[model samples]
Target: MKHKVILVVLDGLNDGVARHAMGHLQAYAAAGRAALYTLTCELPALSRPLYECILTGVAPIDSGIVHNNVSRLSHQRSVFHYAREAGLSTAAAAYHWVSELYNRSPFVISRDRHTEAPDFPIQYGHFYWNDHYPDSHLFADAEHLRVKHSPDFLLVHPMNIDDAGHKHGLDSAQYRNSARSADILLADYLQGWLDAGYQVLVTADHGMNNDRSHNGLLEEERQVPLFVLGDAFSFNPDVEPRQTELCGTVCALLGVAHDKPVCRDLLRPAV
Candidate 1:
């Protein structure tokens, strides 16, 4: 049977300390229903490039989206691309950078903020412009999209953790609290998504350092958490998945054919 997918990317959430802060996610990971892994982010550990990386399953060096400032519509086919091609609906309640990558370049808020164009890669989109946009609100927006569109592939990205990391160092209470707050927010909606038959993938693009910056080789900046919650995943994974494999994995769960590489080790035999 084909499964629907909801990919929730908590931008810039790290592997070590922040992991402890996300109580709801950790509980889900421990309950035996979800498979957890530590994903190694691609080089240049920046947001925009890694966003493209996670959605396109292509490395920065190869995609030429190596820098965050390189703003334009993606040239590579993404998970949304393949899902739409297979006659599946796709939607996103994410940051504007996502809109810039998939919907249009140099995002114009008036025209692109609340989009419902069937032809776009992200067919139904609700994009936020500022990093300060509340994670709680983003999740609500995602829920709205889910109820209204019932999209086959949904991308729900929240930026509060990353915004806090940039404003304060990773060691600060602010950063930790931001993660904790996100955990509380997830507690309100995750089970509903899963109960509704949406296989969930919660992960991060990259991590933040104590120095309050990324785009470096520090372990803290390179490693992030990946949690796959659904029957589609192997309950106990034996291999670490790369960030680039996300697109393919989502495609695989949605039964959409794609040319990208998937993290097959994480998948169950029936999937």
Candidate 2:
């Protein structure tokens, strides 16, 4: 049977610092079912550029997304395009910008609400202008989309931790608490996906600096945590991975073709 995947992007989730802040994520790593890697993202370490890199396996310079404020993406082929060509259902429960990127592909069900809402379902797919929303509501919307649409490829981008980082600084207790909260929410949904036999990729687009800001060349802002779990990831744990490889990894697991040479299948049998 073909495998399905859920790619969860915990924005600004770091490695060494995150383990100290996110207890649930640390516990999940300790369980031995997941392979943890410190992957390096594109330069400037901003969300939009890093996200474009992950989706297209293209560097920021070539993708022309060095700035985060860019409202539209270039017409480059992304993972969504490849998945659609392979006849797979896709869904994204993320920021409003994500929906704007693809302009709502018929094969993709994108639910995004930039602002906080009294309830989540009410704002599905509508532009919400603001970029802040409760993580609880975001998770609920993701779960609802997963159950209702049952998309083969699901992307969940949670931004509260990043918000906390920017608001309270990376070292503040509020930031740690936000990371922990996101870990708990992820753990809940991860188990559901595992029970249903779906491969999972938990990672971050970028990390935050001590000053709680990003979009710089600092290692603290570039090195993000990557956790690959599920039966499909039953391979040696000693291998190092790069953020660019994830597009191919997801395509491989979902049985699709990816033309980008920058990405390699980390799960391929050891040569």
Candidate 3:
């Protein structure tokens, strides 16, 4: 059977952070293909639009996702729609973003968004389900896969990094600490995939500026670090670090559509 592809979206993850620490990700890059490129979202490149671009391969204008808050519904089909509609099990470990859209899909694990801390559940590891969030759902799915019950596409996302970046400024220790946690969590997820014989892909919605601030149109806010953790993938990840090239590269890595990118593949191997 072909290996299922897992896409982990770490929001506001800069290329600098990924290059500087360079632990599990660097090793994974060495084995597989890694590319740092610009994942430029046209205008209003917030969470919903970014997710819209990622899932539909079209920018907000085309996908009808112009802002973070109002995205008109569509039956045109997306990764979530396709995977679930295809009889594949899909789970999202997302947080308080646009996670609600997956509720009606064929996805199994359900989660609800949480911005405040008191209501969130983490102690017993059992979260209220049938909700439509991503983080808790993804984490639990990974745990189940540890016992050989993984989903076809597991999407893990964390809000702490973006939360810290926006509230306390990107240069603060909060964002730095969140980055570290991202590394650690990524390591854990990849370990689970390796042990369970699954393929994994780690990337992000966009990059945050260490200098503080994300207006969404600038270069810093558009770039994202892309990495393929499994040994089955290979590429020259060290390319011209731009933000617009990520979508194509991601599609390529997933063996989806590498041929028709509005831009070129920034993650393509050096030949």
TM-score of each model, paired residue for residue: 0.98, 0.87, 0.71
For all candidates in order, the CA lDDT equals 0.91, 0.72, 0.53
lDDT of 2 by residue, 202-258 (tens): 889998877879988888788888887877775456767777777777877888877
Which is the better candidate, 1 or 3, if ranked by TM-score? 1
Q: Which predicted model would earn the best TM-score?
A: 1
Decreasing lDDT order of the candidates:
1, 2, 3
lDDT of 1 by residue, 1-271 (tens): 5999999999999988556888888887777878778988999999999999999999998999999889998889999899999999999999999999988988998999999999989999999999999999999999999999999999999999999999998888999899899889989999999999999999999999989999989999999999889888886668778888899989999998899898888888888
Question: Model 3: per-residue lDDT, tens digit, 86-169?
Answer: 455555556433343434222224333321122211101122232223343456544653344355655666565676677666
Name the better of 1 and 3 by lDDT.
1
TM-score for candidate 1, residues paired by index: 0.98
Candidate 3 stretches greater than 4 Å from native: 30-42, 71-75, 104-142, 145-149, 210-213, 238-271
Each candidate: RMSD? 0.9, 5.1, 7.1
